[model samples]
Target: MYCPFCSHIEDKVIDSRLSKEGDVIRRRRECFNCKQRFTTYERVGEIFPMVIKKDGRRERFNREKIFNGMKRACEKRPVSIDVLETVVGDIEKKIQEIGESEIPSHIIGKELMNQLQKLDHVAYVRFASVYKEFKDISEFMSEIKSLAPQSVVSYEQNPSKTIDGVPL
Candidate 1:
């Protein structure tokens, strides 16, 4: 393996371990020249379905995109990196189980929203606002109402109540 630090072509594996799920292998390597150590992960490459975009374009399935979207939504929230990683894994497994040559992008988005809704309400709304493209405050408020009907009802009953100091 090439060493990332010096771009050396030679490296020695110092240690190797399998992931708890047994789906990935982690390797600790040291550069032969600089002796710098780095870790690398290995996983079996599986064929994934092409994503049919909304614009009628087809693209290769990208795992990073999903992770980044979730990460951005969960930012400043109480969710952990491990939980997000597991959610991504679950989504990947679901896609693989579909076993189709092509899949619609909306399916992936809906699955992500479902997972986020169960994980964190704030994160779910954050993702939904962008994914669903709310055009006005009413649309945004409608989504919040659907997410927590009881809270919305209580706010409606109490006109004095405000969210972030703004009357709801």
Candidate 2:
């Protein structure tokens, strides 16, 4: 494997193990030139279907896109990278299970939102705000309230308190 830090093509695998789901292999490699270590994942490739955009254009499915969106939503939250990876893996498994050649972007968006909603409320709201494109504060607050029925009342009482009740 090529070393990402120095671009050298020589590396030694320090560890190799199957992921929790046993579908992917995780490898920890140490670069021969830089002595730096990095992790990589090994999984079956070229099995994902094409993604159909809202404009009716078709493109190859990209897991990095999903990872980026998830990373942005999980920003400043307690969400971990491993959690995001597992979420992406789960989504990929779901899509592959559908056994279709083409899938709509909205379907992917809905699936992502559903997963995020269960993972972290703040991340879910962040992703929803962008994916759904709320027009005003009312719509945003409505979405938030739907996620947590008690949020509206609690927020009204203490506007500065965070979701965990830590005073801001």
Candidate 3:
């Protein structure tokens, strides 16, 4: 590696250590010319796929957006940031494994919904309301009922209340 101190092309690694997760390498190097010591970290660069929007627009994949969306969904809920981070990481890794240069935005949305549904029902509904853009009360109720089928049973028990005569 090139030495930053004297711009020398030669350097000796004094020590090397792996990061906690083993995804990074920390190296202590000494410049052969200037004898200066420096630390460097090496990591595998990730090439993320492009996000093809609903309107045909494309943009680089951003993990922060995923984290923010999950955070918003899980707000005031029992879910933790670490869980959200893992979900985001899993989605990112899955996309990367596909080896495609572009991925549909709807697919990403579906993945988020799938993970959130398993994580928390209330949070899933909160996210679905925004993601699916519920236009009417019936749509929201339908989603909530589908999310929790027990609600369907309870609503069935009350035959007086009818959702378009289907009894919810």
- In terms of lDDT, which candidate is strongest? 1
lDDT of 2 by residue, 124-148 (tens): 9999999999999999998987877
Error of 1 at 106 (Å): 0.2
- Per-residue lDDT tens digits for candidate 3, residues 1-168, read 788877999776655555666456566878989999999886623446678999999886766678789999999999987677667767765667766677778878877886887799999999999999999999999998786778646644776753222221
Model 2: per-residue Cα lDDT at residue 74:
98
Ten-residue stretch with the least lDDT total in model 1: 159-168
lDDT tens digits, residue span 1-168, model 1 = 788899999876655555666456576878999999999897623446788999989886777689889999999999998788778767876777777778788888877886888799999999999999999999999998888768646645786753323232
Q: Clash pairs of candidate 1?
A: none
- Which window of 10 residues has the lowest lDDT sum in candidate 2? 159-168
RMSD of each predicted structure: 13.8, 12.3, 14.8
Which sections of candidate 1 miss by over 4 Å? 1-46, 149-168
lDDT (C-alpha) at residue 115 in model 3: 80
C-alpha TM-scores of all predictions: 0.63, 0.63, 0.62
Q: Tell me the deviation in Å of residue 66 in model 3.
A: 0.8
